[model samples]
Target: MSTVVEILTQIRPEFDFSQSSDFFEDGMLDSFDLVTLVSELDKAYGISIDGLQIVPENFQNVAAIEALLSRNGVVP
Candidate 1:
């Protein structure tokens, strides 16, 4: 989603999220970023991301994030 890219860019403008597959493995995002991202995602998509859903795997890339949103009953 373009909104996903926009949110990520707002969080960390230096990196090109579209080019990265694994944000954590590639060192593109840290734990702090993850926390902030969760907050942003929750607000932007109207879905709460917490507990086990906050794992690294769910925040690894755009695809993973999309899947997480879907699991949380968010359409996209």
Candidate 2:
């Protein structure tokens, strides 16, 4: 699976995603970015994260994204 940072970079390489705890609050990501991220995540991890898991909390940071991926059957 691609790391959250990697996927995020593909979507928005201008920002550094690791320095912030809340991407949304920090203005690092928006709703459109989130949708693109979900698509990349599914393609990279072979795990489908449906709408239920596409909430802000689940995408706050790298840790949150990893946790979400784990819940969706990703190993790490």
Candidate 3:
């Protein structure tokens, strides 16, 4: 959980990371946010997230992001 929090914090420090579901509803992250996040994740986690994988379903919230990372064998 801390790993997820750390990642999310690095991406958006202003976000209230305790509530992962509110990320989109609160407009905490936009399209460009996803792009930057994906790049960061690729470098930080040593995993590549292709263009097709960059969808709202995969990046809507912290849990979703963590799931995506987990699927790619990332620690988070």
List runs of model 1 lying over 4 Å from the truth: none
Root mean square deviation (Cα) for candidate 3: 2.3
Query: lDDT of each prediction vs. the true structure?
Result: 0.89, 0.89, 0.78
* lDDT tens digits by residue: candidate 1, 1-76: 4478899999999999999999999998999999999999988987778788889999899999888888999877
Q: What is the overall TM-score of model 3 with all chains considered together?
A: 0.80
Estimated TM-score for each candidate: 0.92, 0.93, 0.80
**Which model, 2 or 3, shows the larger lDDT?**
2
Q: Across residues 1-76, which tens digit of lDDT does each residue of candidate 3 receive?
A: 3466677688889877777685666788888877888888888777898778889788887778888888887767
Count of backbone collisions within predicted model 2: 0
For candidate 1, the TM-score is 0.92
Top TM-score hit: 2
Clashing pairs in 3: none
True-structure lDDT of candidate 1:
0.89
Off by over 4 Å in 3: none
In model 2, pairs of residues that clash are none
Clashing pairs in 1: none
